[model samples]
Target: MMQFHDAAKTNRSSGKVARPRLLAAATWAGTVLVLSACGGGGGGDAAPAASAQVPVTLGTAGPGDAQNHLPLAVGHSWQFEGTITEGANSSPTSTTVTIPSTRDVGGATALVLRESVVAGGQTTVIEEALVKDANGVAVLAAADDVLSKALVPYWELRFPLTAGAPFVQLDKTGLDFGEDLDGDGRNELVSLYSSVQVVGVESVTVPFGTFPTAVHVRRVLELTVRRSSDGLAFDATETGDAWFAPSVGWVQRKSELVGMGEKLSSLERLTAYTPGSLGSAGASQGATSTTGSTLATEPAWRRVLRASASAR
Candidate 1:
């Protein structure tokens, strides 16, 4: 099993908070808001190659940290095709999605565009959430303590199962990470945040070869804390796995939430990265000053349309 650190006691140069008191009240939380629509790609229609690279590494370090970093440029766009399973009781839902360039949104670390089944045909939408940081930038920062505090008993179990594996930043709230599967000395920690914690390390066997595993610890903070044995509390934890790339962070990831007498999972396969046109079009702006007010009220489907166009 993975060893979890005291989330409330870890380092905090990055504004890490005590385990959120009510994160468990939320079924899902993480990431940013607002992103221009993209167009093109997949098959012969793949969008033109982006001018720069998109950062896709994983870990709890700063951008400069070689372990977890991203090459994703400001105006880059990419496609994501996967399945969304609401729960074991529900049928698996397949989705073909994309994330718009990060160059035009506010407080956005990442944008997700998803299209899935609706009443009749399909629905496309964008999840424009916000990534809160001390500096207020949409950028990702690591806060091990905050995350550990949130994920409890369940995390203790899950963390041990899939240590050192890549997992998605369920929410654009900030941060992502990918492990360096290969031992070539390249840092592949993709993204990270204050709510998620990486505790211990493990080695597991896979189809590729032996890999160093990363124990991902996560839990939902209950609105009200129930006292457990001693002084500990009873909280829910969700665990998952991720595989590191050679030089890149995580080339693929699969995550799940198993707690509160239930389990949920999401799998993502990331291939390439590209810098979008906005980065080239507006060279003066930084990620923090983008115009993302549209995210506050816009529906997700509209964002999907925008991302589809941007890809083109």
Candidate 2:
């Protein structure tokens, strides 16, 4: 993720830039929400919402199902081109996601997806560890050059995709990004609450090709940043919609961030895809036992935040 200082330097000259705190809050919110790639499903005790019609079961053709919306095979890669617009300024950006290998995450074999993003002449790379089972895909850990952290296992996509059935993606508090958001020379603690739902299935066209059966998923995120010393807080909301093609993976995505007198939007479309040879055996390995496993209840970032508060 881009640092808060980088963002400040990028938009400092603009008269329409938001307040210092709001700018940092919005930037951090976008980094966390938009950077995480696609998929949606229910987790833990959360139940799927009722559907008016029969729910569509995706990738149900047994092991190595060719119709799986998200293929976790090594060597699979996706390229995207997009633009980010804030105020009247817009910049071109590109992203590439690839599954370089698989590693054990919490005793489960998980695909290591490396996502490289280039925007405004800066490149940022993030590595995510994920596992997929019959239920859906879950993210276990994520890291970058600056920080590495394990996440509370959460479903990125749940099976039997149904319209209007939103599932909780993440509802965690006390996230400290280690950036001085309020300019008090200390980072603030933030909370993230998000949910995802399959809005509909539609034909979506992009540079890669026209996907006749694209599952449109919508994710809504709320980020709250609080300063401990002054008890000041700010809230930001982000809504993202992604289109995933069966057997092809994510095809398009659009997201918008709204906060304290600022709005930032981005749109990305698939430009290329490279399929991997590894089949179901690679994807399902060590994934079975990880289903519903709840070893870590709190994220490492939250723990750090709690410790920081106590020390102060």
Winning model by TM-score: 2
Local error of candidate 1 at residue 84 (angstroms)? 3.5
lDDT of 1: 0.28
Each model's lDDT comes to 0.28, 0.55
lDDT of 1 at 242: 41
Off by over 4 Å in 1: 1-63, 86-195, 198-236, 240-250, 271-290, 294-312
lDDT of candidate 2 over 29-102, digit per residue (tens): 11221111111111123232222212323335424323677767877888999998877899999989777767
Which pairs clash in model 2? Answer: 40-157, 40-158, 41-157, 41-158
Clashes of each: 70, 4
**Poorest stretch of ten by lDDT in candidate 1:** 33-42
Candidate 1 similarity to native, TM-score? 0.36
